[model samples]
Target: MNLLFLGDVVGRAGRDAVLAHLPELRRRLATDFVVVNGENAAGGFGITEKIARDFFDAGVDCITTGNHVWDQKELVGAIDRETRILRPLNFPEGTPGRGAAVFQAPRGRRVLVANVMGRLFMDPLDDPFAAVGHVLRQVRLGAGAGAGNGVDAVIVDVHAEATSEKMAMGHFCDGRASLVVGTHSHVPTADLQILPGGTAYQSDAGMCGDYDSVIGMKKEVSIARFVRKLPTERMTPAENEATVCGVFVRTDDRTGLGVRAEPVRIGGRLAPHLPEA
Candidate 1:
């Protein structure tokens, strides 16, 4: 159980480079649990509760979102009391927050993230593989009777915009998830694998901000709305120095899956990965 998913943090140079390198990346990847993707973290779109309490005081235990998760508008009523802020589990059923939960890490285990949101070219909610197979049939991962009382890990972000629906929701949560990353296309995709039904896929874990613009916005106003097709302003972000993309697994405490999976660029313009802990 080592998990760490990041991707999608756009504004303010991707939230000051993930609050300045996520506490040395959770002490050089010995991380016990940490999910990010604050739906473009405030200026590129949504997410705001004082920036989700400054990403939970920079330790980030959970916070996922997609479809701009309500572009800030008071987080649609403060995300129904912020249960660690998650949105897009096929919204529409009183959609406010929650797309999935189950936190508690550091030894007592039990992870279960799950944010989900991929309806082809976007915004067609529901049926994100039947809402992630009804929460993977109420969690079950590995520990005893078919992984005992379940949940020891099981990330599953998938906030896609079609990379074939984020590699078909990472082979449909293969092996019942342990990673299955991907976020609203900010670029970073080199296919960090582990699949073969043991989860830990990648498809895209890109955008933490400033990839020299145009995915993190601000490339000459996204190139004049694609060479003057119309609307020219309104696309901020990309305030320079930012390059925090993510994904990093390491599960299997008792069959919880993902034995290991890397890809986690750091600092500015890409070209740096941190795995071996």
Candidate 2:
């Protein structure tokens, strides 16, 4: 099955780009399932119920988030009502919303999607390795595990800042997950490759927003912060034409392991690299 996992969507540009391209992208890619990180979809902070609903309406099957998941105060109440949106599994116990969930694809395949946050250079939450292991133990992949009960595929979204931390998680879940990709940073990495264990790995999927600015924020404001070393103004999402950045993986039906992993960067300032026709 073909699975498309989009990176963090930042503010209006990202959301708009997803809404404009996602429906067509899904059809053209023949995607069975889609997961988008909507953490920074709101004004470069957090996602809101309206924005999430927009994504769902646009063909996104699941939404994952990171530290910015709680930026929108309204989500604290609304997240519980929504099952498609996932917070970091390593989040403190009893946190609103879920960290992992299983959804039946349109083609009758069961997919297990899990989100975990890394501790290095991030909020030191629960052990991500343990948290992910627990979920994998629960959701066994392939028909041999079971008939209708087995999870057909597993996709792990490791939202983090450190590349080594993300790579470690990918190997940790190697042979266990169909694909393991990172998010958080707004720069897409070029290390898309299938591991020896059959899992697909990418250091980062980047942000689904304009790449002309500094990590999706206004360029001038972000530069001032670093150059002047002083708080100038609140960061806002770049309003230029945005790009849809992500990793596309096609997994084997029997083993649920990725056979092909491709980087998808379309529109905006980034060079266009859509899936091959």
Candidate 3:
């Protein structure tokens, strides 16, 4: 299955960009499944129900969250009702939404989607390594231990603050998961490769927000906050230009191995790298 995974959607700018460009992208890429990080979809904080639904309507198969998952109180209840949205598996038990889910993609194939957050430089949470291991075992067992059992692929979203942590996680899940991509650090990393064990890996998928400013934040506001160290008001989305940044991976159905992985950057100031026809 061909899968597209978008990075953090910062605010209005990011959402607008995705809505405007994703349709064409999906068609051109022939993506069978799409996952977008919506943690900051609502004004660079947390995703709201409306925003999450908008992403769903715009061709995203599942929505993933990171440290900002609960910034908006309404999401706690809204997400529980929807299995398409996923929070980190390592979140303390009793957290409102689910950490993972299995959804049928195109061709009636099952794809297991799991989200886990790295603990290093992040909020205190359960061990991601353990959480992910448990989920992988369940999928493997359910698939009849390599029978493939109508299970086409497994995707892992490692939302992390550090590149080292993300890379480590990718290596840890190399052969067990089909694709292990990272998010949360708005800046995209240069590396995008299929590991020796066949899992696709990217240190960071970048942000699906305004590219003209600093990490999707208004330039002046962020500058002021950091330079002065004063409690300045939060930054808002830029109204004009925006971009969508992410990683796209194609995995084999029978073997659940990644065939191709590439970084995608669109609109705003970034140069276009359209998918090959």
Candidate 4:
């Protein structure tokens, strides 16, 4: 099974790039499932239902989010209806939407995708490791395990600011998940490898937006805030062409572990790369 996980989508540029290239990517990569982080899709804040629907129409199977998941107040109520959109699993009980869900893929295969937020330097939510472990225990991965019983693959999105926290989560789910990738930093890391336990791990998948600016925001505004040590204009997404960043993992059907992993960067300022199908 081939799984593609895209990093945080910034504003218009990022969204447009994904919509334009995703269809071709699906064909070229022969992807069975695709998950994109849409937290920052709405003017660099939260995702709107319309935007989420746009992604789905563009062939995205699922959408994951991070700290900015609730930036759009309407999502607090609408998320419950859209099972494909996932927020952090560590959110307190009674949280509007789910943190994890099992989605059906081609050939009657099941794929479990979980979105969890790291507490370090993030919101004080439930323990992400424990939250993820609970779900993994409930849904074991294997082939021919009966309907709603076992999944063919597992993908975890660890949205965090600290690289250490993200790396810890990858190691924690080493053998259990097919791929564990990080988001929120907006800068793609060079380390992309399969762990000893068979899971594909990347410290950060980076943002699917223009890299010429400061983490997708306008360079001048971001620099002013940091240099002056005072509040400036609100940060907005860069309007230039965006580079879609993500990770692609091909998992073994029998064991549900990753057999190959590669980083994906297309368009905008970053060099382009697409894994061989």
Candidate 5:
């Protein structure tokens, strides 16, 4: 099955880019499932119910979030009701909304989607590795515990700031997951490769927002803070055209392992990478 994982969506531009192209992109790539990180989708801080609905309407299978998942106060209640949306699993216990779930693919396939946040340089929540390992144990590839015949694939989105932590998670889930990719840094890394264990791994998947600014924020304000060594005006997302960026991976049906994976960037300032028709 072909699965697409999109990085953080910054603002209106990011949402527009996905709505305009994701449907067609899914068709061209023959994607069976798609996961989009939407923590920053609402004005660069937290996702709202309306925005989450927009993504679901746009063919996104599930939405994952990180540290900013609670930026929108109203989202707390909405996320609880929406099974398609997810917050970081390592968030404190009793947190609203789920961090992992098993979803159905169009082709009668069961797919597991899990999201976790890293601690190094991030909020110290539950141990990500432990949380993820626990989830991994709840189900296994080709052998679902009464959920179905078996899980056809697993997608793990590691929202993290440090590359080392992200890489560690990838190695930790090497043979157990179909794809392990990182988000939160908003810069796409070029080290897309199928690991020796058959899992697709990428350090960072980049953002689905304007790349012309400082990681999708207004450049001038971001630069001022760095130069002045003090807080400036509140950061807002860049409004220019956004480039939807992420990774595309195809996994084997029998082994539930990744066979091909690569970075995907379209529109805006960056050079594009799309599957050939």
Candidate 6:
């Protein structure tokens, strides 16, 4: 099975890029399941139900979020019903929405998707390592006690701020999960590799917005906010010259081992990896 994981979608440009390219990319890659990080999809804040629906309509199977998952107040209720949208698993217990779920791919394959938030350089949360264990157990067991879902593979999106912490998780979940991809940094790392244990790992999958801007934010506004150290208005997304960044991983259907991992950057200022067919 092939899983295509996209990083944070910034704003209009990010949305348009996905709408314009995802279908073709999926076709070329023969993706079975696609997950996109949408924490910043709506104006670089929490995702709204409408935006989430847009992403779903655009062929995204599941949407994962990070610290900004609650940016949109409306999602408080929408998340309760939207099983496809997942917040960080490490959030305190009783949080709205789910942290993990088993979803069926087009081939009738049961695939597990879990999201967790790291603690280093991020808002303090429950231990992600422990939370991952809890979610994994649930995925292995299914809904009822030991009833079992026979899930063919598991994918984890570790939304984190620190590279060291993210790399640690990749090793920690090496054998148990098919893919342990990182997010929240918004910059794609160059260390894409299949771990010794068969798990695919990447420190950061990068953002699906303007690469010329500061982490998808308006360049001048972000620079002023940083250098001036004042309450400058948040930078908005640039409308022109968009790019989409992510990682494409193929895994063994039965054993859930990663067979290949590759970084993808298309359009905008980033170098293109996709070639003419």
Instruction: Looking at model 4, report the run of 10 residues with the lowest lDDT sum.
Output: 140-149
Candidate 6 segments exceeding 4 Å error: 139-147, 275-277
Put down candidate 1 lDDT per residue, 189-213, tens digits, no spaces.
8888988989889888998998998
Worst 10 residues of 5 by lDDT: 141-150
Top candidate by lDDT: 4
lDDT winner between candidates 1 and 2 = 2
Question: In model 1, which regions exceed 4 Å deviation?
Answer: 8-27, 31-115, 118-126, 133-135, 141-151, 158-182, 185-206, 209-214, 221-223, 230-242, 245-266, 269-277
Which stretches of model 2 miss by more than 4 angstroms? Answer: 144-149
Q: Tens-digit lDDT track for model 2 on 1-277?
A: 8999999999899999999999889988999999999999999999999999999999999999999999899999999999999999999899999999989896678999999999998888999999999999886787633465588889999999899999999999999999999999889998999999999999999999988899999999999999999979888999999999999999888999999999998889889888963
Task: Kindly state the number of residue pairs that clash in model 6.
Answer: 0
User: How well is each residue in 1-277 modelled by candidate 3, as lDDT tens digits?
Assistant: 7889999998988999999999988999998889999999998899998898888898999999989999998988888898899999999889888998888777667788899998888888999999998888776622422355436788899999888989999999898888898998888888999999899999888888888788888888889988999998867866567778988888776677788888888998787666573
**How much is 247 displaced in model 6, in angstroms?**
0.7
* Candidates' C-alpha lDDT: 0.86, 0.92, 0.86, 0.94, 0.92, 0.86
Task: Tell me the TM-score of each prediction against the true structure.
Answer: 0.35, 0.98, 0.95, 0.98, 0.97, 0.94
| lDDT for position 163 in model 4 | 94
lDDT of 5 by residue, 1-277 (tens): 8999999999999999999889998999999999999999999999999998999998999999999999999988888889999999888888899899999888678889999999999887999999999998877785632444468889999999999999999999999999999999999998899999999999999999999899999999999998999978999999999999999999887788999897888999999989764
For candidate 3, which ten residues in a row score worst on lDDT? 141-150
Error of 2 at 192 (Å): 0.3
Candidate closer to the true structure by TM-score (higher is better), 2 or 6: 2
Tens-digit lDDT track of model 4 for 1-277: 9999999999999999999999999999999999999999999999999999999999999999999999999999999999999999999999999999999899888899999999888889999999999999988776543645689999999999899999999999999999999999999999999999999999999999988899999999999998999989899999999999999999998899999999999999998998888
Kindly give the stretch of ten consecutive residues in candidate 6 with the minimal lDDT sum.
140-149
**What is the Cα-based lDDT of residue 267 in candidate 1?**
89
What C-alpha lDDT does candidate 4 achieve relative to the native structure?
Answer: 0.94
Model 6 C-alpha lDDT per residue in residues 141-192, reported as the tens digit of each score: 2122223656667889999999999999999988788889999999999999
Relative to the true structure, candidate 1 reaches a TM of 0.35
Stretches of candidate 4 off by over 4 Å are: 145-148
